[model samples]
Target: MDTIKKLLAAGKFDVVLNQLQERMLSDESEERKDALYYSAVALRYLGRLEEAHQRLDALLDCWSDFGRGHQELGHTMYALGREETALQAYYQALKLNPALYASWDATARIEAKLGNLQQAELNAEQAQFLQKQPKQVVGALNLFHEGKLFKAERICRAYLQRNPHHVEAMRTLALIGAKLDVLNDAEFLLESVLVLAPDYNRARYDYIKVLQRRQKFPQALAQAKLLRSDEPYNPLYKALHANLCSALDNHDEALSLYDELLSDKVGDVAGVYVAKGHLLKTLGDTKGAVACYQQAYQLQPLFGDAFWSLANLKTYRFDESEYQRMQAAVSANETRVEDKIHLNFALGKALEQQEAYDESFSYYRRGNVLKRETSQYKSEVLSQRVDAQVEYFDRDTVARWTHTSAQHRHLTPIFIVGLPRSGSTLVEQILAAHSQVDSTLELPNIPAIAHELNGRQVDRKKPLYPYILDELSAQQVEQLAQRYVDETRVYRSEAPFFTDKMPNNFRHIGLIKRLFPEAKIIDARRDPMDCCWSAYKQLFAEGQEFSYGFDTLADYYRDYLRMMKHWNQVFPGQIYTVFHERLVNDPELQITNLLNHLELEVEQQCFSPHQSDRSVKTASSEQVRQPINTKGIGQWRKFEAHLAPLKKALGDVLSEWAY
Candidate 1:
């Protein structure tokens, strides 16, 4: 850093550029980032703004989270007389590193020149405030924006130890925790910052995100309302408010807000169209949803999400021209990794619809490979989690640690859980067909509770959750149970029963039993190959990381089976298994047995669940909208020749499940 400053001061820009070029090529260390950054600075000083912009773009291609690169790019663009482009880059830089004083100053000047005095003053004030922060705090912010999260956390923690009241440091650390998926710790840190500085708008926005991730929808909605009131004209806050309303089942209001935002023709118009499409799809307005998704891609040709959403409908077909357009977009030089993933999946679906199986599989494999390259999932960690549950939740252990506390029986929650694409959604739709039941999307409350319990520490030791279940007091269990009920109330009506159909909740059965022993648990079972292959072929919006690879997905299915077997042994008859084949083969017998299990009278709606107007949000949404059929019963047979890896991974479990 001192050498770079001295070189700049000495007016040796060419020498600095040469040295940085060599370092960038030869050194793969952390210093490579500095080399890349300083090379751009040298290029800018040498009156080669285009070269500087190109180098910064390359830097960002390698590290998209590098805020400094964006800031430098902004400076280069400004020097090249592109004020609007520079402003966009500056906004992005501030989004990544709000403490970038120079970017703030630049933005203030640019906005003032554009005659936006209010925003200019706000940026100027931000610059002044950030200038007062310690250098260490600024360095930590830079590191955090560079995606060196662990190093940034260490620096932030060290700085906060000396200046604990630094709200920005707290916010940065909380954001790091969020990126690491330790949302509880992030929520705690942000909450503390807000308490100390109640008017901290940035911290409040982040707090809302943590709350949303934790499935505290009411709290998130409250925060969104506050932000909307503060800046009623801000499209970002209005979009968030609309999304929160949709999450809380206020579909009509969310649609209205989205329409209002769209009418203004504001930021990310294609994104607003996609959001409206999703809400319309959930409301069973298929034609309207299709039109919206089509409009989204038409407006932004590179927007792969719009294409993927259309394919995910499972009923949409692509013409040859549409396929060619997506292929071109996928191969485009400027297409981002995220967009490519979506395009590949969408193209795979399009090809599969045309019966081009090999080409379809290739696209699917490519998509999954790209997705896995960035995923943090490890099959071994999931294996250990399964093993922990088996070791900790045996019949004898449950009998000894069982909290004899009163289970919250005021509202019965029918839990439909199993592997992804294992007919859980279909089962939920059938059950929800009853007049006494309300269907909800995959509620995240149970998994959030499990995450909290698994992340709790004692004496700084590793978390012991299923094991910790043995030590919970009656009051604690009741409180946890009630919290689930209260958190889920937003998705409920006056119906006697509501379904929580989160397929991954199969892993948290023991926790469910501990909290709500009387709650009805339905294990929605399907043919292993069909279920695994189906999930492998689909791209989920989030979570279900195991589905991205074939062998890992099959092994995950095996683990799911092993865990389910253990749960059945530990608490026999508590869970009722519903086989997809049997249900489809004999609807009358299956529906009767299902109704008997729930202790409800059989309704005709259960037999014709497709006629119900309930919202379905799973990948099987389109499939469930039609009457039950055997079309998907043996889907694995179509890809049997290529499924040897999956079959081998499953081993004896395949024969045991009689697949």
Candidate 2:
């Protein structure tokens, strides 16, 4: 590969092609993907435009997100005197990777020749920006876009070692950290970059994104306000501010910003429409949301997000033409993997609505397979973590760390913990309907704290969190508990209690007990088959990586049950279990029992939680807005034939959960 790169750099295009061809004869490994891309580049530079185009088409057919492959195709198109095709290729390249300087340069030149002066100038500016970056930074950016995140991090860190104050290098490293799920390091690095380069709009923008990812909505909104103030008319900044507002539950402000962006005819028009649609959906305006989603797909027929949004409503049925469009989009060679995944899921839902069970399962399986290929989830790693938790947080260990002081006993956070798609959101809605209770989004604070306590070497054989909890002093415990309260205050109103319906919080039940001994914990349970099957079909925005594969999903459910059972035995009667089946079957009785468990007086509004106007930000948002029903109970039965692996993996869990 190094020799071929050297040959290409030396303009020995023929030699480069020869070497790649020889390597391709026997090397059918993953590196062949790179070989194909390099061969396309070599062919284009050698002025073999037709061959280059053919190679690029074949390469892209297998690797749709290959940004450099698209860039080389752009060059080939230009050499063939096809300016429009070349421009489209460049656009696609930049869509996959904005850091491609050559693509940006080519786009600028084409736009200028076509007399799109404004767009040409914007493209020129982007090209110039990339051209001005340090070579190492540019290389790191390319590697990052290629998904070689560790390599990119190494480059950025090596660059920063000598030039410690280089904001670009720091920002690039921070971007890698965010991608690697090291949000704490990413947030800190971005903060430092902003402190050193206060006027760096790009750094500030990145800082806001990191903050948003950390679930620091108010802080992110504050940064977004500063960014928007710096460029008040910038459509991207305005849209970002709107998103932050939506995150903070300022839906009216978010909708207004979306309207402004749309009316101005700038800044990702289709995306803005989708954002508006999401806001409408959260606000319980199904008709308006559906219309907005329809408008988005109408504007960009290949936009899979719009199609998925409609399907995710769980009740929306696709018309014949819409369904055909999704099929065509999924089948299109130009469709990227990310878009293909969304289209597959949408098609699955559409087929299911039409009662084409086999076809529906095929699409769902295809989407999950594609998604799982990209995920780094290991079921054993999660099982190991659960084992550590169970081992470390035994009865004696729990008793040792139990908060005895009344200093923090009043901090009664109602944690609804379970697996995703297990009706946790419904429990939250029911509790949030109570006058004394506030509801927040799936909070990330507990997980963030756990990550911090796990120390820097998180992947070590033994983690530091649950063990470290035993070593903390009373003051340290109080401070940590208070930090949770203070940090989460942004997400609450004047209610006496707030609900943190983070399903994964079940893993940290011991920590929760140590922090707030009097806190209410609810174990949201569902039929094992239903829960696993529901999770397998859904494409979570993030953090539910195990759901992308049936075996992983089943293993995760089993781990959850194991961990919950341990917590139950350690702190008997401290956790209330809410079976989703019981809740749906007898809402009033379940609601009464739930409130009684929390020692709260039942309100009439609790029985009619679907009427609450509070925003819901889960995939279950649409479902929870309607009356409770058994529609989702036996959904797995439709695809039972295709669920052998899931059923086998679930094993005794099916019988235990009475599925």
Candidate 3:
């Protein structure tokens, strides 16, 4: 055994194997058992998994009291992807020594691979609890991988306290702080890691991420530059750099980088295609975006982000066949949690589009549940970690500004706000169809920016949003607002007016109105059940909280309505209401009214979105590809039978929509 260890430590794997062969006739039971286990592990690591399995079986048939040996065997089995055997090995190890954290961690990995996240988390917790010290970092990392953030934080912090210079511990702490929304803490921890180890490119890259999450754009850019200085050719750095540039509205530079990345030699760069698709979509080249999606799909079909994005570009109205295709795509593909949530929602939407209400509800329900959990992870986890008392804007500010702007006190820009699926895309498509108007699809990303501005919302009752309008000087507001307009200039170069249709802008109307007094705000409404349920069914890429399931979706719908009602009451005629059904039914009347409100000329194509050829990167893609049909007019009726729970929950609140 001692000789084998020396060979293994000296990197003499072949020598170790030869020694094992010689030990086939060892006189003692311990020597024989040792020889069998070592050979099995060596064989497994050497990729001779079948032989390793046979050897392991022979050993287990004889002596099996070695807990650590069983754990090592399980690790080898897991490496071979024989997960059931790995679980059995872990079970045997635990049967011998229940306190073994390695055995628990192995079990956790198997459970996670099977997608039993709850059980995986529980086992990870058990493993972590068994070894709650700095030496237990490995087990703690397993807990973190399983998304047990709180436990991971405790383990990491323990190490950080004793060994402040530990790079891995600091990196893990930074990540945990980021997830918990403690941006400052995360930033400090990561920066300290770099101070101790300036050559740590991975930590530098992750620092950029922390800055990005905090919406510290300039800092993020600076850190990104520093990172590039160290590793100029790293695709990961370039990708991150491209993302920051895009966020900063430096699209020209972003596009150039993205174009260069189109031929990226990196085998794992999926976002190059996604980035290319975004650039094309923004350029009004839907066909180009389609090609990019196809490329992305080819690279990773199980990548649900690609599938959902592709479905968003579909010309089919999510008809039954198209829905089946999306299902096949999702089923055939593997994905991250966010992508899975999106795919499920898209599948539900396709079912809804086909008038399969019950089936649609099932898909919507599943997607909504995932979305809620995701949101909880965000607001409860990420947001909680950031600096407290950071503020963001909401609709009340828009109302105040609209009222003032009407009085010529300010010139507010026009806002197109609603739930994502609630005619926001249609509104933009219709408005962009006009001669004087340009539409920038769901953008300006208010949530991330808001979180950054406020530092943290220490007291939710006194949110930073309400105070921003009363503070920021004219110059600051104008600069911030104008910078936004100039950045989006690519989308509206020729038009006199542009629409920002980011749905969550409903939360920041006050800031928008104050920034651009001339801004006309459009609050598009469909039936509550329709809008909420519709959103639940469709899969959005990012920054949507209500698209996952029924109860959570319903609550989110209520919050949206309540906020909108406050704005309407605060500044009545300033916010125009466009019923989605009415707009589809009387396109001309609604177009004329909507444009007249924006002080733009109504174009003939405004009513014919199908002719625009602009990419529809929302779930409404298929509907917009056809002439305004009454298919969606009675859409809520078919779902009414299946949405009894939703309807009962909504009560007469949906009566205003005249269900």
Best by TM-score: 2
Itemize residue pairs with steric clashes in candidate 1. Answer: none
Candidate that beats the other on TM-score, 2 or 3, i.e. the better one: 2
TM-score for each prediction? Answer: 0.90, 0.97, 0.64
Q: Best candidate, lDDT-wise?
A: 2
Model 2 clashing residue pairs (backbone): none
User: Can you tell me which runs of candidate 1 are displaced by over 4 Å?
Assistant: 1-38, 48-67, 81-104, 107-132, 401-407, 456-462, 636-642
**lDDT value for candidate 2?**
0.89
Candidate 3 per-residue lDDT over residues 85-151, each given as its tens digit: 8897787677555557888988998899899898699789878865764565655555565456889
Better of 2 and 3 by lDDT: 2
Candidate 3 root-mean-square deviation in Å:
12.4
**What is candidate 1's lDDT per residue for 459-526, written digit by digit as tens?**
23345766777667878888898888877887888887889999899999989888887778999999
Ranking by TM-score: 2, 1, 3
User: How far does residue 501 in candidate 3 sit from its true spot (Å)?
Assistant: 1.9
Q: What would you estimate as the lDDT of candidate 3? A: 0.68
List the RMSD of every prediction in angstroms. 3.2, 1.6, 12.4
Predicted candidate 2 versus true structure: per-residue lDDT over 460-497, tens digit per residue: 88888778877788888888988898889888877778
